[model samples]
Target: MTKCIRCQVDVADNHLNCPLCGIKLRESIKDTHVSYPEYPQIAKRKKLLVKVWTFVTISIIVFSLAINALTWKVKPIGWSPILSIAVFYIWFLGQDLYQKFNINLVAKTLWNNYLILTVFFLIVDNVTGYGKWSLNFVIPFLGIATGFIMTLWSVKNKSMWRDDIGYILLILGVNVLPFILFLLKAVDVLWPSIASLLYGVMTVVGIFIFSGRRLLYELQKRFHF
Candidate 1:
């Protein structure tokens, strides 16, 4: 309880000032209020930086598009758009996902590179000619790389993966896409699809060897079997 010297009032609340006297309370008063460090200024600065980076990146994209418009031609199809994409990708990496320190950086980089390259190839194919590489090789390889990483993660951290294996298995099911593409006669080359099939098989074998009984546990949990 804080006693107001001026009003001779005994206050029962915890505050820096007297309720009736409206004067500063003594530091020796019991039951001091809880203190918390202020971080709003730092948070505001971070937000400001994000806004600045967004503006700068958008400006660069506009400039690249202007250049591309001026240099539109045959065969090359003006490479400025590629430059813009690259710049945007870098900005996203630096500003958005770079601070995610807990995630596996190597796996993140591989997946990001796979998607970015796939997009770049799609653009190039659209401008020049569609060789089916982006749809055939690029997408399938992305799945292969991601599956490999997920398998390694599960094997390396079996104790955790014991409970989380179902999601990983479901995601790895994308590797079946290439084989489906082949069966639909969507792709003339079978080697890429065969490679994806081989990757899927390897992953399954790895899960059996490394995950073992845990894999069965996760499967049962997933399927309610």
Candidate 2:
């Protein structure tokens, strides 16, 4: 067996490449042994858990739709859609936590979930009589929390800072939206928006202050400059 330098995993001589990353391997004497450990029982258990979770959530969504259909005349607020979106968000969250993909992919998944929840609550707010709570409070505060968490995580995992900086910047762009909406009168309460914007600005400033020229290099590389 030969080891893949990148993945640091053993590869059988019969394989021409690393199984995980697909990098070509150095020539070696032919062997028939498995290069990686096999956990058939654990794999089966995970698969069973996934199937059970999917079946349960899908059943709940279907039941909700049926109930909504039957009660359409009495209360037609499309709460079923909200429930469905919540389910989807939960599935994303669970998958991210369980699969533990690379940090960049996890960050993007979270960002996508953020967008999904933004739209989700907006729809909920509109359907529930446009209370403006979603915009005035929920979204802005959510943005602030997301940005703060991303910055904190990136700082904690300094090794992946390059992978996270671009995403953090993207999140900061999202943070700008709350205040912009406030300016356009789309958001009534100013405090949450101001707080989000302030947090976003502070995050960027902190990155610049601490990262120094590395931040510039990362920005340049990300922008292909």
Candidate 3:
């Protein structure tokens, strides 16, 4: 018998994968194996990132509150920064909940939703209020960049990255397509309300398709029933 590296379960000598855990088993003992310590190291790095992001989120909230308090009399439609802070807080909280509950799919869905909502809110707020800020642009840009980084990390860790890739594409399309339409003055040619409705439908469809696939794969792998 040989041991499954992931679940530590013993498998029959002739088995190619662990029956209980679905972990791939070596055909022969001659295959080089990763050390146990490496698993802990990866976990440690993930924990550290979580801590750092939490700290950054808290700092943003505190700083925003302080600024709002100091400039209460001169508040300039404070929605931009407020929305940015809200986005960061939601992202952080979603990640924490996912880690605590091991609800990876829910966490990913919330993360993607918050990211796209942040961009839409920022653009609408800025355009309607005739205000522009560098940070407004920064939030969405960072969202896409960080999404890509997380996808790459997931791939390296042997986790599911397909859902992430789909999310990144969806966000990119949502954020960029609006600008193209605006440049062409397509809003005058097309009804804004109808366009918005179609966009919402597309976003929901994309999430459903990608998330459904991941759910099916997980159920089959874990229960096979």
Candidate 4:
């Protein structure tokens, strides 16, 4: 549509001057004009997958609530509470997995396992009317099992709680509670509690032996008092 008089070259990009010669371009005397490509306009739309997923989750929640209400009416034995707790836990776990759930395998493992034990014991307590099994048996064994897992995972990873050994030590401390209950004559089944305490003690001793003074210094820094 234009020509650079100095360079005698045809320019077609709607330039005011020649690209190479920097000379002003002269417009053509043609009746017609050059046309460039034009992009088509598109309408914005919502993400279908997200909308579907949200709708499904809402429907499930509503259905669960209706089931909970009906079950409670037929036999009110804490079934509705357990269902509510389970739903809440499911939502929590989903969010955890969706977000940053990479590191701290030990903590996540313990937390989830404990949730299972908690729900189980809650059901047990409801079914039995009134029982100490949840506290005497479930809590002790689950705590010991959690400690064993944390110890095993820490050994496997080698970098867990190197700076902050408090969590590990706290688990080991809880391992002593069952023995205290035994001494107080609170639990009928003492053997299982004793076994759990032994396992926790052995795990702590193993860590101390293998980790040596590094763990001691870490413990000192963590305890201070």
Tens digits of lDDT, candidate 2, 1-225: 989999999988888899999998864455545588666797677767777877888988899989999999998768898898788778767766664467656567668878989989998898789999999999988888777777777778774455777788899988989899999999899999999899889888887888768988877887888
Q: Can you write out model 3's per-residue Cα lDDT over 1-225, one digit (the tens) per residue?
A: 999888887888899889988778875566766576445776677778778777877777677767766887896555446555565757656666645655345426546655665665565556467343323344434444545455455456545443454454444454454345545653333333234435445644664586777656655665587
**Model 4, range 83-162, lDDT digits (tens) per residue?**
65665556556545553366555466465657675776757576667477876688788888787777667767875556
Between candidates 2 and 4, the TM-score winner: 2
Better of 1 and 4 by TM-score: 1
How many pairs of residues collide in each model? 0, 0, 0, 0
How should the candidates be ordered by lDDT, best one leading? 2, 1, 4, 3
**Alpha-carbon deviation at 77 in model 3, angstroms:** 4.5
Worst 10 residues of 2 by lDDT: 26-35
Model 1 is weakest, by summed lDDT over 10 consecutive residues, at: 98-107
Q: Against the true structure, what is every candidate's RMSD?
A: 6.5, 12.8, 16.3, 8.2
Off by more than 4 A, model 4 = 1-74, 112-116
Better of 3 and 4 by TM-score: 4
Off by over 4 Å in 1: 1-43, 70-81, 104-116, 157-167, 208-213, 216-225
Q: What's the TM for model 2?
A: 0.75
> Which order, best to worst by TM-score?
2, 1, 4, 3
lDDT score, candidate 1: 0.71
* CA lDDT scores, all candidates in order: 0.71, 0.82, 0.57, 0.68
| Candidate no. 3 TM-score | 0.35
Residue 22 local lDDT, model 4: 86
- Measured on C-alpha atoms, candidate 2 has an lDDT of 0.82
TM-scores for the candidates:
0.63, 0.75, 0.35, 0.62
